[model samples]
Target: MNQPITNAEKLSKLPWSIGSNALVNVFVQLTFLGSVFILFLNTLGLDKSQIGFLLSLVPYTGLIALFIAPLIARYGYKRTFVHFSVLRLLFAALLLLTPWVVSNFGAEATLLFITVVVTLFSITRSIVVTAYYPWAQEYIPKSIQGKYSATNNLFTTLAGFLAVTLAGFVLDLTTGLTGYLVLIIIGVLCGAVAVWGVTKVPGGAPVEVGRGVMASFRDTIAALGDKGLLFFLAGVGLITLATVPLTSFVPLFLQEEVGLSSGNVVLVQTGVLLGGLVSTYLWGWTSDRYGSRPIMLSGICLLALLPIFFMLMPRYSPVSLYVALGIAFLQGIADMGWVIGSTRSLFVSIVPPEKRSEYTALYFACVGVFGGTSQLLAGQVVQLSSGVSGSFYFFVVDAYTPLFLLSIIFAIASLFTLRTVRSDTQVTVEEFAGMFLRGNPLSAMTSLVGYHFAQDESRVVAMTERLGVTRSPFTVDELLEVLADPRFNVRFEAIISIARTRPDPRLTQALIDVFNGTELALSNIAAWALGRVGDQTAIEALRQGLNSKYHSIQANSARALGRLGDAKTAPLLLERLQNEPDIGLQMAYASALGNLRAKEATSPILHLLHDIQNEGARRELALALARLVGDEGHFIHLYREARADFGTATAQAVSAFKRKIEKVLNSETKVLSTLGACADNLARDQLTEGAGYLAQLIEVLPADHYDPH
Candidate 1:
């Protein structure tokens, strides 16, 4: 029999678990560097069509990347990232070569070459970026994906803020060739730094993918065949169509229409990026707490108002221009909903992990087409109207056009799509337990687990417990009906809830009897609940479970024993130290021993942890030993060594370890000591207080060897 899985193990692969903040750094740097080209386009003597042509190259290359993305997938993200980086740097350097080529050759020839360079860069950058996209789904945990990806976008937007402003400032200071060359040189340097960042991001095993490019492309498109995914892709396209015009051509609009100075215009432009950057986490938090659709719909409605606000910008005084920029900032914030909403959770949730990159490429490819076409159309429309300067009262209008109205229409249209984007708001196993503690209807408890509601049947069982009254509102037999429900999550949630809230010992015994036959997920939840409620009466049953041959069951029992705080099982736990073969189990063992405050098992833990296979477990075990021994030297040594190993895997691992150790040391030193001083003999009763210190120590040890008895 297998032991139950712990909460920590279940969420190990989530992006935040892998130090999602690193992505924020990546986004900020890329956006800042990427936006420079947009700011300086007109200064290079490029007309509207010419600038449009340059921007058009990004998608043109994206098309090529679309084809090669699968091939890159074959080699994996790590190699694709490295290759794309080298190409980007080379292309940045290639931009510096542009002026010399144009000076020597004809303008048309030079422009053609510049377009080629942009296209190639765009293609390679696509592979680099898209390759990394799958990792977002792979690395981040499901619970926090929305928040982490949104925060990542927020940081990326800040880069846009600085890039737009500085690009304007640079162009404002230097002449045509000199400014362009300088921006390109800076771009190369940024690209080099970006390369370093990607290399540092640790990679896991590559997913099995289609062997060839065409087959991968086929699979990518096939992913959209899922109705949910199809709507998501459509939503992405519509959102991009609505927003790309604002980002790509807004600089030109601000300059020519508002008649603002270049420096001042850049500041106004910052409104969009800053607003976006500030609002990302809010939208993400909302999505996590609520659902993606409501937040997304709100953003779209807000975006629909941008055209109305644009009409007022020309009427405002210079000081009031700040107000206008503020509106632009609002537009940017609304735009954050689209970017954050479209890219991550919905995409990953609808598709399997193996096919994420392929599906993501299809989504972005459609985005490139729609986004690219909108920018080209906006530019052309502006170019045709550039010559029609109408004097409105005393004000001069350079390009007063109705094109922004199209943007407004697109945004409004997006609201209709929200109705189809459904996710459920249901209580989780954790919340179900909390509900019992309060003695209320669990159904009334607000939850974000609705996304998994339709997929699981046990939810009904859990709901029954939440709704059940002491008078037996529903028959006891109706509760047992939940076990037969085929949906795993539902069964899992129901069994756990029943075990927690129901007082019948026989019911618990029956639940425990059938627990072994349940799915790993549901079984783990049952085990966890059984342990949490301190069902000492079921200790004999739990002890029987510990004797099971299954690794998962054994591990769960180890954890349950710790939670039970039974010194009687200390020897059982200690005996297993030399028998378990799994590193993850060893970590659980260290954690369990620490939880029990089994000071008797300390030397065994310290000795076994020394030869641990996993660095994370070893680090945790060392800290546990320190707690058991009550030595400041152990704390210092653990802190110093763990910090040194922080960069190897996920920075989050290092941070998690540091936080655990510090929390333990701090609590033990302050709160616990004060209580111990006051309680005197009463201090011994606070077993968990000491257990807390040991728990941290055990959790911090390296997980090299786990031997289950």
Candidate 2:
């Protein structure tokens, strides 16, 4: 009875649908799949086996959809999807009753209650899952599916981050039923929003059917005979086997074994969401350009390292928390790549569109059966090995250690299975890694900045901060090479870092080249670095930059020229100052004149000072006047103007100005004395203002302030 949705209308509503789906995922992660749920159950004294059994039940519940899928096709994908999705709102409300059930009926009854509620939630979710994707395929055009999926992932990750962070903070603050109840309320609200979003999406036609459910199952089984699908399934099966133990026990290990605070545990889990947020686009780009097989293999290889990191974690320390966080982040990256690559290569690219629903259903069924069995077995393994310990090779092994080792073995086997996967494009492992390191922006920048494998920019920036404090020549050399990186921000950071160290000719030339480059922002930053380097050789290049069409380049060049203190460039600086229209550039010229102490610049500087209205320029002109004539009154005027113009920056600027004044006073005492005598004669005892100002300056100047070294 529903009107058919036109393709154009479907496209129009696609973004809203994706956004709403992301909101639903946030609620799911916070309540069902998240650590908070596990922690809440742990608080109820439900041990590893019980928790694992509950988790295993989630995937196994997917079998219910085997019966429901036929009904879904007979009824309608959209109608069935909306009906069950709205029904999920009831489960959200039912979750609020858990604390009350635990209080009245004891842990055993609470567990039974939770099991029934969650099983229903999972079954409804399974039907919705079966319908949702096919419904999406009907509306989304094939060409933009990749982009749409990536955007959906981004939104989902961002939403999960918010949900986890908020839930963690709430649980940290509250110790009782109130926190869990509040989270349930939030989940219900988000569920309602998700249902509303689904209503906005147009409905698709119900699929036509002639055969029974048995024929559909036979067709799905027959489709699995494809070699590529079999190989892909083998790889996914191994990965799921490896990850089952981790998914079941890692949260338990962190909270129970490591004794990490709940807040810290949530922080570690949030790292996975953060990593996914960052890497989804990169994986998408790599899959499109290089081929999904390379990405899949690469992801598997990274995943293989996770068990090793787990093995290396200390029993109880802050360092162990960080290591676990690192493991979670790596897991996120690997999982994202694996999902995108497998979905694109194994599911979409390989299966015929007509058979997609059946094949996809069969795929989930295989994963669920194998993955659920692994979880149950892993739970038994953990239960049997409780308090068991031994020595393996040189390292001590414990009950949880075998699980990680098993994961490693399974992960390595998945790589072998992955070798059998067929794709339209192919590359060797070495070539794939090379292309990723060279072509990906973050990867290339990280390698260039330092050899950090994680490719985190903050780590590189932190290294830059330690340059002066640590004084490592090797590190400085590596940072210098970063100056030529294609990313402008990285190059700018490198320049700033290098400027903090002692000057070198290599660094000077690098700054010179950047100053001459076409990027105006970098050019301006390079000018500042050259000035900080105090390299006289760069003066000519900086002088040329003064003629640049960009005002920032000219202003920065003039400031750098002043920092070099070359008196020979005074006339040119003076000429630029008179002709310059921009008030900020004029301030740079005046400050430069002060740095150079060019007596010949006095007339033009004084003329411009009278006409300048900008407070910053007026302050700079006062400093220039004091530097030119050695007048104490000019210093006082400069301090007052600086204090008035810059509110919070005023104190620091004034202190720096005072230091500059002291330096000049100590170095040029004879010149200052001569100027004071000349000022006395010019005033001729009428005002005696010059003598009074000189006396006040001498009184205020600290006698021991100058270091004699």
Candidate 3:
């Protein structure tokens, strides 16, 4: 019996598996997969029906994978994957015989020969896929599976991008069967190297041979009875059905209708792969952090927009290529999200590990059957409506337009079905959508500007200058109109922009309303914005926010109260500081106390500073101490420590510390000037113990930077 594989041993084999997988993907994309392959068939004078039929052969033949799973179980994953992979390479080499077949037997015979070769290749490839997934599950630890999947996708995209780009250039230069044959030769070589890579990976344990074919078939049937699994299958099935027209017909549409050259077609396809390449890591991060459900929903929603973009591309127009390319790039990103999200949902969360091979085979069979049939049906839809045109409202509903419209309907249905997918981790659709939107760079920037700076502060001042230079300002009432915008980020940005210009009572109440809203992140930003507006009426509301249960609300409320500079709230801040054990919350209280210039806080601040060991909390305490004491020593120590830490750290860490130091030294002009004044006083009075440190700090400072007045 084989020794049971530990997680560590499995993890050690991931690099080999991932590398082999990427190499195989490159071979497929370059030779018989992707838009390039469809374009190749088009060049041979194959109609939509023939091209779709050829494309569907791969998935339709994948049904054989259900029976192949048992063979893989007996043979072992590594042995089966490696053996079939080597056989698939020989089938790829047979593509070079296509030109010879056409010369001797005519185009119809050539098509038949090509079909036989591809069918074998497809069936062999499907067996490899069946064995590969279970192998990966055993090899890659679940703890880092999302990250590992992302990395694997990254390699695949990079390889695909390079391979496809080269094939496009070759096809553009040669423009005949010769160029395609050369691509096939290259693909076969890649497959050979990929097989060698696979050989390096550790072979997982084989299943017991005593389990007969009937037993395996029964296992697969039982696995399909799972309701959660059924819902997941339905969701994936809808998406695959929706996208059939896209995968099967879009390349034909682009070349025939959009009138793009082979070079431009490759460029558009490359753009899509580029989009996937860029977003693979981001999708992985999101999947790992938030769970796969939100990523799936977000991807489906984005995918629903692709058909609309496709519909917008005008036939035979110069702009159509650009529009098609843009659509392809966006489609790539959406597709990647779908791939990553669905993989996690299906392999990691939904199916049981013991029966993973059986369930994986079953899942692929469903996709292959449904998705393959959809492609064939879509081909007939195109052929039946070939010359058809009509008006749907003001827009023309052409034959192609109907397919896209059908795709849109199915995409929406997939989104709803995905909501019912049960996973170990659950995120509500609403919360997931909100999190994704709020995490956008524009939204995050707007919130940063709103919460962190006063109206006349330099960052806000610079922003106003840019706004004035580039665009007209919204009138107060116009800004108010935007305050009720549907997107929370939009409304949040509008409220912040309005607060910068005019802090009216109505605007103050609007900010208060947002602060009391259900979106906790937005509510925290609103509280901080209320402080920046400095409305006395809002101060009471801000105080009420301090009593909220959420730590963020309490922290932001403290920071806001400090910005209001209310001496009366000093006692309350001091009490909170004494009780608050969270170091970050303690830092907020310390900053608030300093802003209030509460002398009562001095001893507690010093005590907290001495007791705290967290670097961030220490920096905040030092800044607060400087603000309270008008002492140069605190800032001097902070600056020195930041510099010393910067020297020994990585480049990224150095840059971060440098930014933090600059924010302190520059953003707080009043604090820096006060520190300078205290330094001068101590030096002039010859207070020897403290004066020496002050003088050294002054020597390091730029001249004429501090104005005591």
Candidate 3 residues lying further than 4 Å off, grouped into runs, are 390-396, 439-709
Candidate ranking under TM-score, highest first, comes to: 3, 2, 1
Pairs of colliding residues, candidate 3:
none
Q: What TM-scores do the predictions have?
A: 0.55, 0.61, 0.65
| CA lDDT, candidate 1, residue 181 | 68
Off by over 4 Å in 1: 1-35, 315-317, 387-400, 424-709
lDDT at 443, model 2: 33
Give lDDT for model 3. Answer: 0.77
Best by TM-score: 3
> Which portions of model 2 miss their true places by more than 4 Å?
1-10, 390-396, 437-709
Worst 10 residues of 3 by lDDT: 465-474
Number of clashing pairs per prediction, in order: 46, 0, 0
Error of 3 at 494 (Å): 28
Q: What is the C-alpha local distance difference test score of candidate 2?
A: 0.73
For each candidate, what is the lDDT?
0.61, 0.73, 0.77
